[model samples]
Target: MTVESAILLLPWIALVALDRRALAGDVELSTLIEPIAARPVPGEYRTSIAYYRAVLALRAKDARSARALLDAVPRPLPRKRHAEAFEYLGALLDVVEGATERTLASAAAHEHGPRRASWLAVRAHAQAASGDVESARATLRMLRALRDPQLDLASVARWELPASRLASELMRGEEHPFR
Candidate 1:
């Protein structure tokens, strides 16, 4: 291809790369949120963008924004992977929105998927938030014991790590005395 052709393709190539990174839960993708959101996402990539934004909003404790973003995702997501991610992130949002049952159920159901670590972390959050401290501590112990090499929770669900830690400390009565 000519230099001009390559130049024209650069943006598209970048979008594809970013979309894959987003799917793989690359935390760095969060830095590109503004630029990506400002550009017009092609239909093929719209769901990924929506998912990324929704997850970001959830991490920031902005449930309203998260819900809006998730709702924008097309029903019957464009791909199976996207659908799985949608369900997982939606369950997280439900918990953040004060409905934790779905997250607990999702964590139990997807016990061995690639997202198992994330599921456990969110389950712990749900249990702790709902005043089930003992269950939350047990879930956190399970989360800590898991030896899965694929436990890259920060990439996909950025909130889980902190949420898990907070739940653990709260349950153990070890929270820092200072705010």
Candidate 2:
């Protein structure tokens, strides 16, 4: 791979490693992310690295850190899809950090392709966060009905990973929404 592409992979690899450790309940996710956070991000990879770090911070329930990291990602990322992903991550953070109406509205506007399931997940999370358990459950049903295996962190398109992970977390609760 080219140097630029290679540089981008660092955060993805660290994220994957964090995911594994998180699943195993073996170590503090923050600890696993420290080394990565300590490194100087390359200019070409700055936005992508910030995005990944935001994802990691969100996973660790560190919304303040996630917000700062995400805010550091420059507008109009290198690719259109990357910009879209940034928007979605921002919406997800809205849900997590308390701003359901806006997030729900954002999620409502998307209804096709990889975005469909991912937005549905955001909708569900927003509903759950807003104390609308019934609506959240229904939204989860719609997301589940999609039955798209790609709507999972392990196999999802890179941009959709956060939403997929959110969906899985909501699904895992089965009898309820969120942990």
Candidate 3:
């Protein structure tokens, strides 16, 4: 490729690299939020920025902010993302909005294939929250059984680590402190 061609591809290449870093849990959203928000980007890129911002908000334990950021992400995200917006939106509503027995039931009853682990982890937490520790343990065991080394770290960092910690607490006979 010519130098001009390489220059033209630079932006795309940088975006992809940033995505990889985001997935690897190597990059934090706060660090990227400013530069991304400073410029006007569109479509999938915009969706990605909103996704990261939501993650940051969630990490700070601010569900309301995460919900707001998630609202900015357009529906039916372009299929390249790890967690679909619809699915996460459902989980977010369950975990942050209503999160009652009805919410847990809805989340548990849903058919989430590729996203099963994430969904299940949330469901388990819901179970624990509702004081059904046994059911929560079972659900978390199911999540642990589904663990695969090949799954991307981004998803793991976003959900699994917390689930694992909860599971560990369950095993040690302590009530899971997570909300």
Q: Largest TM-score belongs to which candidate? A: 1
Higher-TM-score candidate among 1 and 2?
1
- How close is each model in CA RMSD to the real structure? 5.9, 6.7, 6.0
What TM-score do all the candidates reach, one by one?
0.70, 0.66, 0.65
lDDT at position 27, candidate 3: 43
* Comparing 1 and 2 on lDDT, the stronger one: 1
Give the lowest summed-lDDT range of ten residues in model 3: 148-157
Write down the lDDT of every candidate, Cα atoms only.
0.66, 0.62, 0.57
Once fitted onto the true fold, the runs of candidate 3 whose alpha carbons sit more than 4 angstroms away are 1-27, 76-83, 109-112, 150-165, 170-179
lDDT of 3: 0.57
lDDT per residue for candidate 1 within 1-179, as digits (tens), equals 43234224543455556654554456666676556556665775667767778867776778899889888766877778788778877877777777887778878898888778768877877887787767766766676577545543333233553355555464456755453
- Better lDDT candidate (1, 3): 1
Worst 10 residues of 2 by lDDT: 153-162
